[model samples]
Target: MMGGKGNSVFSLSPNPNHLCISMEDGSQSSEQLVVDDDDDDLPPIDDTPDLDIDLEEEEEEETRRDEKCFMAPPAPGMEFDSYDDAYSFYNSYARALGFAIRVKSSWTKRNSKEKRGAVLCCNCQGFKLLKDASSRRKDTRTGCQAMIRLRLIQFDRWKVDQVYLHHNHSFDPHRAHKKSSSAATKTTLPQPPLHVQVRTIRLYRTLSLHTPPTHPLFQSSRRLELRGGFRALQDFFFQIQLTSPNFLYLMDLADDGCLRNVFWIDARARAAYSHFGDLLLFDTTCLSNAYDLPLVAFVGINHHGDTILLGCGLVADQSFDTYVWLFRAWLTCMLGRPPQTFITQQCKAMRTAVSEVFPRAHHRLSLTHVLHNIFHSVVQLQDSDLFRMALNRVVYGCLKVEEFEIAWEEMIIRFGLTNNETIQHMFQDRELWAPVYLKDTFLAGALTFPLGNVAAPFIFSGYVHENTSLREFLEGYESFLDQKYTREALCDSESLKSIPELKTTHPYESQMAKVFTMQIFRRFQDEVSAMSSCFGVTQVHSNGSASSYVVKEREGEKVRDFEVIYETSAAAQVRCFCVCGGFSFNGYQCRHVLLLLSHNGLQEVPPQYILQRWRKDVKRLYVAEFGSGRVDIMNPDQWYEHLHRRAMQVVEQGMRSKEHCRAAWEAFKECANKVQFVTEKPS
Candidate 1:
């Protein structure tokens, strides 16, 4: 029981459920504290139901705090060694009370550089993107004003200076406040802003794994298309220029400012072409691009019998004018030197362009394309197998002109293809595809590069498909070249190790085994082996100066004849026409010619018979390029000529020994050192 005195004096009993009245003398009575009867300023207790308070829980909490001293946490005004310790203590206290805590403010001493005091506060943070008028301000800021201010009492101990127990906002027990607080404190490094992190994640996740790491993610995520693919091509060409200084890239724009043509050649490709450009396999069949554009690749055979990339082009169309422009661009890039023989698809535009741009070069159609076209045309005919068999024999089996003629005539008559337009056309252009016609040329058996174009029946039979972007396409192309180069290097190393102390039966063969690559050497070895079966039958004179010998290959009762032209002089020149055209097609001497060379007392293979392209050291040949075009004048720049002369002199003087080289190096250093003094003296 409690009693009210005047207006403020009152006392409470020990029972939490009831308020007992008491006098100032501390005596309890069965009476309640009530408002003064005369004071009309106070409302009646029964009328003020909204102002009711829960004092019973507070009294119970205080009683429990006093009873459970060991189990309960330290009471308020507790001391700790550091701010983190104080924060950690309050964090546990706040967790038990069902609320989140946050650092409100902190300060440190200017002189000692020690953290002085920290004010801990309730976490009133909230989200406010919704449109609730009453909840808007509350969502932004709780304004709870409940905090504990801690200060340094002793030098190392911190004491709770002030603790505001009252809060203006209600505690949300269902919210994961502790988890949110821990996540907020986990980051020690500065993280990117929210918007930037969101964008980065979106872009990276949107990109496919097949996309290159260097791809521009921003543009890809935006899903924007380039202006006729010009921007993509420009970026790729610029990157190529940076990575390969010797690379040549040229682009042509149409009247509408769209990319019409593109051509590119790398240093390795140009160097390879400088040696192997004698027989080029020009292929426009394998056009790998998303734009359905014609991407032609110039392929050449290396000594290892592998196709090496010489150059590439993207043309607008397969028209005569477009091909002319492309061919001219390639010619300019290659300094106007065209291949001796051209092998390509049977397209009129390419044929006309080759005749006009490279008139002296022999033009031949790819036998594979011819066979494919023929097969497609005759597949509908009755007894097509017979016709196909005969066609294959005429195209591939016949080794002589007379044999090919007789086989082709029989095939036409037996298949009733004399009236067929495709058969007639093939026969008309037989020389362009027949091996017997081009047998003498050195093609290294490279008829065509089995590449496909997008516009065709999707003949990506080689597993190389079109690319979506210019960079991706170029990357695929470069990777293919890298793989080929590595394979060829490995082959060269293995072949070098496999050679024995004495590699061949004859002196010339032994010398060639050391000079040529394994592939070329093997081809030469076959020719040398065949020489034992070949003999000179008769001799004839051509132009009254060159003597031609009819060499015959005899086996039991059968015999075959070949013409060998021998020019006997201080510099002997030997040539053969065995209908195989092995030397003309492969740059290697045939059996008939080899037999003649042996009979003529030639101790070694003459330098005239050896084309540098087939040699193992072909890549060492120097190929000159003058910007984008050729120059008519030799040593156009006097400074380069002077430098070359000086270099040659130094090289000659230092060729004796390391001592001579060292002396030259020291002299060069002394001369260079005097330049600074000479420049400082002026004029």
Candidate 2:
């Protein structure tokens, strides 16, 4: 049917049952045309066999395309028109690279229809379930960190702000090709160069083209250098997964297969972050574990004005790269939500890493760390009480920005620190530590390092401390989560069942008790109670509907004056602002603001002033039965497994005491009755 110049030429393939034949005319041109070879003498092929052959070729072609995709991966700053468009682009890249992606998480504003951002991730990004696996099929998920994050910039434009294309597992392009290549014939076909095959094999084995030898991640090295307590820690994590699949952890394996770094978070922490993730306090000075790894705690403030654990990381070293890796892991686990404010100690590596990783976040130095720096950097300032006093005044006692600047200049001049590099650097970064310069920045409840200054009420403080074993830390971490979530459950029960007695006869007080969490309501109650002490109000000025006044409050023997401003807008709308910035910092009104409200004859608290994060009745997607964020809500299998896990949790909790057991029994019976009635009803 075809000829090349003179003799009939057939395209050579290892498989003689190939469908297409290559042909060329007698012309001098070198192009060959492919066509179906309909040999009249050939025997008929069965439909099923032909389908099988076509499928075999199709699979082989797919495998080849997948291998080729490794050469190209998405980079950060890639832009798209919509969240779906960004997701589709990343999903195609994942498919082409022989992996799967899923919606890790996405967030929309409270009353908005469109999403603010979304985190699409590798399907295998988190840990695989360590539950009973005898009846389950093999899963390919090995906690791969490969993912792409999409952030909505503005007006329907989404940008790929973060991209991670490294997979911890290997993909074999030889799967289909090796199977098809078995169909041999007495014919020689072309093959790629030997160097190319070797290069690909090395790539498959190492996956370390950009990785340094010391931190050879996902390398196929059998030699392991796992240090003290790491094995026990790994076993402990495995045991945790056995109990609940809600815990996620990531660890680095060196070129020699050493486990030196790890990060972990649980379902409760993820759900808490969804609500209270605006301000983050990242601290690492708490512990030096058995392996000498620095334990970093990701902390957030709850509605209770208490520090809660968001995640924890044990790094290999204090390098900027290591912290960057830890930050990226935590961000990915939290669905790529960057905090509005980030607080940490003033370590150069940490500061640089925070700035680079969370570019949009306001990185503030811990007040205690700032003091420590001042003491160490200016050793002579400690010799004279006058010098130290002046420095403290500049750092802490300033009430206004102008006052702070004047105090700082006077302190530097009085101490003769004009040539000191540390003082100059501190002056350059004054906005990072000085509270006078940062009154506008919201800090939630974190004004300084939680562990350094305040009594750390977190359960971890009781269970974890310096020089602890990795296993001890993990065990304590798990125990604390169990207790913390139990506390939340108890508080939820109290909020739903009981209301606090009103300290004030105001209708606003009654509404607050119902709207706020019990702890937050108590904080509000304190402000209302203190309104009695706030007197001697004098109008400073008035313009349009707005009025500014000075209010004096008595605290002990000292009477402090505060600047308060209010606007009586149309429709009974009242706005209050205080120079104290109590609502801005603590998400609650100050006594001064409350006094202004009473003066304006406004009975109820402003609806706009009530923060949604402090609301008691809001439901969250991650808090569905207090479940993890890793579960794909759209997947029936994941939902069934999650529900089953929740049922098991009830069984475990009910075993704790007789009261819990009885209550759980009654609840289970009632639920079963409803399910049975539904099944019995006509469909």
Clashes of each: 18, 0
Once fitted onto the true fold, the runs of candidate 2 whose alpha carbons sit more than 4 angstroms away are 1-226, 254-257, 287-293, 375-397, 412-424, 448-459, 487-515, 543-545, 553-561, 568-572, 616-683
Residues 12-58, candidate 1: write the lDDT tens digits. Answer: 11111101111121111222222221111211111101111122357
Instruction: Assess candidate 2 and give its TM-score to the true structure.
Output: 0.58
Candidate 2 lDDT, tens digit per residue, 1-683? 00011000111211111011111122212222222111221111111110111212565564343222222234443445455445544543444345555566665554445566566666556654456355374555577777665555556666554556677876433322321233212113233222121111010122224656565232232212223454465466556655544566655433221334567776667767878888988876653223333577888887766677887876656665566767876775666779999988666767767876799998898776666566667776645667777778676566678888988888788778888887788778888988876777888746632445322323256565554556566667666777876787677667777879899887778889989889889878888888889999889899999999999989789887888988877896778888777776678788898888877677778998888888888743343133343555433434544565577567756864699999999999999998887755452
**After superposition, candidate 1 runs with Cα above 4 Å error:** 1-231, 287-293, 381-385, 396-403, 439-463, 466-472, 491-504, 532-559, 570-575, 599-603, 617-624, 627-683
Q: What is the TM-score of each predicted model, taking all chains together?
A: 0.54, 0.58
State each model's CA lDDT, in order. 0.56, 0.59
lDDT of 1 at 27: 13
